[model samples]
Target: MTARVLVAGIGNVFLADDGFGVEVVRRLAGVELPAWAKVADYGVRGLHLAYDLAAADYELTVLVDATARGDEAGTVHVIELDTGRTEQTPCLDAHGMQPDVVLNLLAWLGEAPRRVVLVGCEPEVLDHRMGLSPSVERAVGTAAGAVVDLVTNHGR
Candidate 1:
């Protein structure tokens, strides 16, 4: 059966705090989630994510990534995306997976979830590295819990 919600973990593992999403989802693997919710690690594969979104008719899509919103590093922000806004042109790059680009590609494909949300953490360092910074690593569990809350309490 198709999942009602898609939890997509996206980022580059080699780029320090950019791996926040990937780590958060990894933590989620240990937690119990609803059967209708699906979690995936789509690290740096924006095109793959877009195609998956286009092919499936999900009620909601949650994208987890490291976001720089000018706040303190390791700050987790849950922002709801306005799927109705599709003014930007779609661009696809296999190596670079920007959330906006994936959303634009989904829009271009004429398929979108009913609601879209981003679970983003403020990145400390995006430099080439194998692991997340201390701050970002600390926020991984918080972000994972937030994702769990979102999926379980949706529409309640």
Candidate 2:
């Protein structure tokens, strides 16, 4: 059967913790995922994300991104994007688009997933350099575990 839960990791790997999303997916690769969970490392490419939001068959989607939520470095936050409060909150990242944009666009296209959850991480450093910061690297496990929990519980 087609997957029921989609986990997308979005970020720019070259820019330190900007790659948090991708790194989380990488760490999750070693674990055994349910049959209905699908994951991908979608590096920075708005069009790519738009495509998946428009064309995927999953009923639920989990997106991981580097966010500035004023949390400590390596902090993992599980954000329910379906809530109304997120609509007015502006994201601190200038290069990235809000998760709402993806949901709204998919809704407009009549391809929206049944539910969407956003997993966010505060960046210790987003410098345009190679690799994740030490702190952010340490947070990968936490972020990956969060995704696993979300998918394993809701996936079926």
Candidate 3:
């Protein structure tokens, strides 16, 4: 059976704190998840992610990434995107890992998951570093838990 949910961890690991999603997914590897769910680390592979979404009929696609919303670092936010609204014409960049761009590309391909959620963390450092800042590091577990909850509960 095809998976009903797709949990994608996207970001650039070379950039500090931007690797939050990658770290979270790595942690998720140790947790138990529903069989109908597929988890993957699609770091900076926006084109690949867009293709996957278009090829599958997943009901929900959860994107975990580092997002800056002017809040304190390490803060995690769960955002639900309105897939029906296409306010801006997204520009396609093969290397771009931004969630919106991937989703827009899915739409452009005439396919999209029924729902999209972004589990994001406020990044402390997006510099050329290999690891996350202290605060962002601490939030990795929380974000992983959030992803599990969202998928297990089917986004309830």
Candidate 4:
């Protein structure tokens, strides 16, 4: 059976700029989409996201987050992850959702999704502050749109 598509926003809303993914998904929640498109906010629980991916519930997964890619703040990026390059290694902590570990866990499950995309925003601040930084806030909608595009444009 063809798995569905998942758009998961991963980050902590309590931390400044880190909340970009949560905000993006909040915006997406109101938008109309196909039944196969599943959107969720997986804040701080990287392990949860990992197990979900391991379930192979999605043919394609779009993970939205604030990534420190050394780019300008608020920069939106759509990066396609080569899951084939993922290693089948398990992490010690299965309680946290470290993005890299989550992806790796999927490979360890031996049924990783066919495609994984990362829709990230460069964060201005990741300190212990609620809400997104001004720069990151501006990119939320753009990232949401990007996630939608990834799902709709996927060939499988």
Candidate 5:
């Protein structure tokens, strides 16, 4: 049987520019989508998301987050994590315990999704301030649309 597809957006809304993922999810709230697809605003609970991914009947998982890799503030990129490396490795706990660490651990624990895609946005700032930078906000629509297309095509 074909499994469901989960599209999750993770970030800390309180931090400036860090909330792009969650904002994208919010924009997707009213979009008409196939039944096998689920979209969520996960905030910052990476470990919980890993467990959720493990428990869900999903064959494909799409994760959205912000990356510090220097691109334009609103530039978006998609990456596929290596299943073997993610599953067999212990991730470093840098800058506090990261959610990717949990994702890698879940992969190790046999809860890995059959296919995973990470949609990352380059952020200009991640300060303890309010609102996304103008550039990041501008890319939300394009990113959200891309996510929808990915789910619609891959959810089968």
Candidate 6:
């Protein structure tokens, strides 16, 4: 069967560069996509995202977000996550936005997808402000393109 893919943009747009994911997905929505690829803006709802992952049956799920990776700002990264080995954790906040927490929760709920990937950018700042810095903003187009490539190549 052809893999079904979900491209999710995750972050809090109110926080400076942390809004990278949201912006990327917003841009991606304007692009043409394959029938098997789906895009969603999860913003800061980790638990809701977790449940959505659990409820849906997708073969590949790509998570796009701003990560605190120790790198130069606006740097884009693609990472493949190993699933099916999630550990049990305590209560979960349905509105949480951390990708790791949401993935762990999905594993806990026995809803981990077959394959997962993370496409993220290094944030220059994360403050209680709206809009992205120049560097991070520039990376959004690159990230969105990268995600489209991923979906087109992997989901078909």
> Which candidate number has the best TM-score?
1
Runs in model 6 with CA error above 4 Å?
1-3
Q: How do the candidates rank by TM-score, highest first?
A: 1, 3, 6, 4, 5, 2
- Candidate 3 residue 45 Cα shift, in angstroms, is 0.4
- Segments of candidate 2 deviating more than 4 angstroms: 83-98
Clashing pairs in 1: none
The clash numbers for all candidates, in the given order, read 0, 0, 0, 3, 0, 1
Name the 10 consecutive residues with the lowest summed lDDT in model 6.
85-94
Q: Candidate 3 on 53-116: residue-level lDDT in tens?
A: 8888889999999999999999999999877645566797766699888877777766767999
Q: Give one digit per residue, the lDDT tens place, for model 6 in 1-156.
A: 343889999999999998899999999989999877889999988877888888888888999999877999999999998776566683676655887788788777767688889999999989999999999999999999899898888834
lDDT of 5 by residue, 1-156 (tens): 344888888888888888888898898898987887888887877767777877776777888778778777899888886544453475544332244686677767776567788888899889998789999999888788888878888834
Residue pairs with backbone overlap in model 2: none
Question: What does candidate 1 score on TM?
Answer: 0.96
lDDT (C-alpha) at residue 115 in model 3: 90
- Cα error, residue 148 of model 3, in Å, equals 0.8
Candidates in order: C-alpha RMSD to true structure: 1.0, 3.7, 1.5, 2.2, 2.9, 2.0
Clashing pairs in 4: 46-97, 47-96, 47-97
Query: Model 5: runs farther than 4 Å from truth?
Result: 1-3, 85-99
Question: Could you tell me every candidate's TM-score relative to the true structure?
Answer: 0.96, 0.83, 0.94, 0.89, 0.86, 0.93
Candidate number with the higher TM-score (2 or 3): 3
**RMSD score of candidate 3 (Å):** 1.5
User: Per-residue lDDT of 13-128 in model 1, one digit per residue for the tens?
Assistant: 99999989999888899999999999999999989998888888888899999999999999999999977748677866889888888888777777766899999999999998
Query: lDDT per model, in order?
Result: 0.90, 0.77, 0.90, 0.81, 0.78, 0.87
Q: Which stretches of candidate 3 lie over 4 Å from their true place?
A: 85-89
